[model samples]
Target: MQIGHDAIIIGGGFYGAAIAVYLVRQRGLKRVVLIEREPALMTRASYNNQARVHNGYHYPRSFTTAYRSRINLPKFVQEWPTAVKQDFTKLYAIARRNSKVTAKQFERFCRDIGADIRVADPALRGLFEPRLIEKIYVVKEYVFDATKLARLAEQELRQAGVQLIYDTSVTAVSKGVDIPLQVALHNKQGVQELLTSQFVFNCTYSGLNQLSGDFSGVCSGLKQEITEMALMQMPESLCGLGVTVMDGPFFSLMPFPSCGLHTLSHVRYTPHMHWSDQRGIDPYEKLRGYHKETRVDRMVRDAARYMPELLKAEYKESLFEVKTILNKNESDDGRPILFEKHMDLPGCYSVLGGKIDNIYDVLEKLDEVI
Candidate 1:
């Protein structure tokens, strides 16, 4: 049996949901459907991340990414005002040693990107070891509440009349006889169904190539990592502030508004292992087979060298997810969004973005396509 729609989006994460809503509400397309393997939206990479609303300060090495974040930050905040958390102070500290970018260079980069940056207050600066930290700056950045954002997405999708299929997986996709593409779906009950649409969007993050089969070439040059983000209750002194030690194997302690805790992630310790997609390895299967252990002790011990107060953090739990990135950007730590159109399979597209606000870039590209 076959069902037809104008478009079939094979991911219910933020990008897929956003695309579905935009097609119906903005583009005025009537028949749209979003499919997800999970029972709900934003439960995977979207919720397990650091939840940072990047404001150009985190990417001094990548000018294009920093500038794009600077441009999109305000628009995202304005569009989702209530879901953003701006109560805590966001601080970026340059390491006196072992940092790729020095304090001066970081300042210049921020200024170049037009990001709001200023010397942090004396008290906040004093939180770090002066010998280890060369300089600290208070940057205008914000953390998002993914739970709230998921709710907002649900509301918008409902209002736009999007049909949502949860707890279903897309096994394969191919050229359709009548439509532009055909998608084979497997649900929890062991039932198989076929869906056809004029357009098919593979916004499945780590699973971008999973359903493409022979057309996987269009989603090549991808990498996936099993990453962990440790959640902790901050010490009283650090409760109202978010801190990041820059440009090296350092750590970041940021407010996680969803649980009223802080997420601590270390550059060297966060990713357990990573693999390139060129080998056709199944990332989700690898993630499921690997054991997950909390590395908060190592993170705190190393982080305490720069900020002694980190020793007081109480580890609550860890959030594990498959973090995906474009293989080409691994050198400079760049995070430009990946928007690929498949010429072999016309009307099929694959989308991936490093950061949340990068959605604007995807939307811009979609405008030209759809």
Candidate 2:
């Protein structure tokens, strides 16, 4: 079938939006359409993720993929318009712990990329707050508010004339490399067929397997619920400071002023205690409260650490959120898996596994492949 759209992006997250923008803006493709399941785009893995534009330090010392990723991210960030300035991001991943990496190492990594950073002494630990085990250097970068970024993409795409279909789930994808591949999408209409230029980018992080590429990693194995509470006052110091944490397993802090939830930060992964996707098995409940006693235990522990005096202060409202977590990460291979593969079909291509920093570059390559 000669398709209607020149390109149909499978998921409306950063990669998908970036791909759509690239196809239309850079490649001059007029018929671009983005299909999204959520009423608004960027609601899945991309939306819930910490929006740090990593400066390559997260990758390994000599890893080749890490080196390439580091080299590529800056070029991608620079592609954004002045309105999406490099500094638009609010949080930075400051690597400091009395552990594997040190302040000097972080500074060296920063210098390699010309990334701005502040070297600090262990005595000024509060400067890095929460994870202030020792005074260390902080490498800061503007963090993209995932939600805001998603919404921004939607508006920009619409204004630019990219047709966007929301609240529509892609039930089945027909893969091929021909001019237009027929895709089976299921939504309120039940089932329908849409043809697009065979170049399909499956930026769907959650449904990689569904797109025909078999990724060994599992997103459903682990889960997370981020509970955010505002500090009594917005500390002038913690605005953009974030840490991997001195005392916990993979603890991180990111501040968001754009979301208006900037008073404090949110926490993830409280030890072995795990949560679930709460898959539709339980009807009538959009959310699941933690097991009563487990909830109390976590509250008490969180309160004591975040606010020692929380035992006295009256608690306010709290919102519990859930998402899939990938616990099985290989060491120092932190570079997101970005690849272009055409499954058994001839015209369809799927792009998978990329971080925000490398999104533009990924799309550039994706277009070339198509």
Candidate 3:
């Protein structure tokens, strides 16, 4: 009963943790080891996700990572029916004519995947609260509860009998003949090396460069930033356009079943943190001049420009947080990389670059590899 495992799952976030659960349930691997740098699971990107179960609204722009991920999300959400406390009627996506994927392309996207979406502007309820957007006409779509999905996944993994260790930090990893991979961690008892089996599932967002003896490729090169905001009233659908305005950047408005919240962010560059292997985020102190404030202001301001209602809405300072993300693209082959070998890494894998929209897809991959 007390043994390493057929898998060594690195990182205790959504993708890694969920893969551990799926491997145990689907592959029936009881003896397993989980290494999490944080004191608990899902303290990373998983918790920082938009918490929106994206409705396959953003699909394959030439089979891009975002598009490819669209294929497996429904199953991911269906896996945990109870964890999901909310989902919108539909997901709306709007794009400016000059964007990478245009209106016509988006329509074809709906037809290609048979994804449930439409071209009409749905009423904003909840934070969808009756607003000034009544007059603005922009291409719109919807998304779902990604955070809920993660919460559900965590519950399911536990029910399926998986042991998760938190507050444990991985100092290094190595591979040899007798022990294919050795994961050294900082536990209460002091430094200890875990002899992991090969099937290592790495769901560590922005922290995948630890594998040693020829697995350093696990850490891909890309920058990521995530900012989360909670909105009081919510609506049935999320609508707005992914656009590049005068400043030349991309932005989107994400609607949730109302974490009693909402979020807005863009995939851009900032010289904050490059390497994903850093620990403990630097807390921001200023109300408006801080890092969190800068990011949120950028997000909400862009969203307000897209959705007219967001322009006049009163600001509520009590509901917002910034979550750093794995910033990169699947186009340059910058996806999560993990090495799987039974008795080699045990249950271990690496989740490289992703958003809440694509993490579920990564989980499914871990299931098969493990």
The top-ranked prediction according to TM-score is 1
lDDT of 2 by residue, 1-370 (tens): 4466777788887778877887888788788888887777776556545555566545534344446556665664565433232432232333334345455555566577565656554534543345533334455444556666776677779877888887776655554444546566667667565555545666665454443222222233333333333322224444334443322222344444335333222333222234443323221122344441223234435434542333343332333333323443334434444454554545455555546766745756766665
Residue 360, candidate 3: alpha-carbon lDDT: 58
Cα deviation of 164 in candidate 2 (Å)?
1.0
Candidate 1 vs 3: which has more lDDT: 1
State the lDDT of candidate 1 residue by residue for 1-370, as single tens digits: 6667999999999999889998898778888999999999989888999999998889888899988998899899998999999998899999999999999999888878887788988998889999999999998889999999999999999999999999999888888887878889999999989998898888889888777443555545888899999999999999998988999999998999999999999999999999887435777788888999878889999999999988988999999999999888888888999999989789888999898999999999989998
RMSD of 1: 1.1
Per-residue CA lDDT of candidate 3, range 1-370, in tens? 1234577777777667666776787778876667787666665556544554444454344345445555555554566555453433333434343355554656676667555544345443223323322221222233444455556666776787776777776665666445455566677667565555655565555545434444553333434333444342323223332222211244444554435455554555222233333333322211123444334455566555555455544434423333433344434332333333334344345564345545555555655664
Quantify all predictions' global Cα lDDT against the true fold: 0.90, 0.51, 0.49
In order, how many clashes per candidate?
Answer: 0, 13, 56
What TM-score do all the candidates reach, one by one?
Answer: 0.98, 0.69, 0.69
Error of 2 at 290 (Å): 9.9
Mark the regions of model 3 whose C-alpha exceeds 4 Å error after superposition: 1-3, 64-67, 85-98, 121-151, 188-193, 196-198, 211-215, 224-250, 267-291, 314-349, 353-370
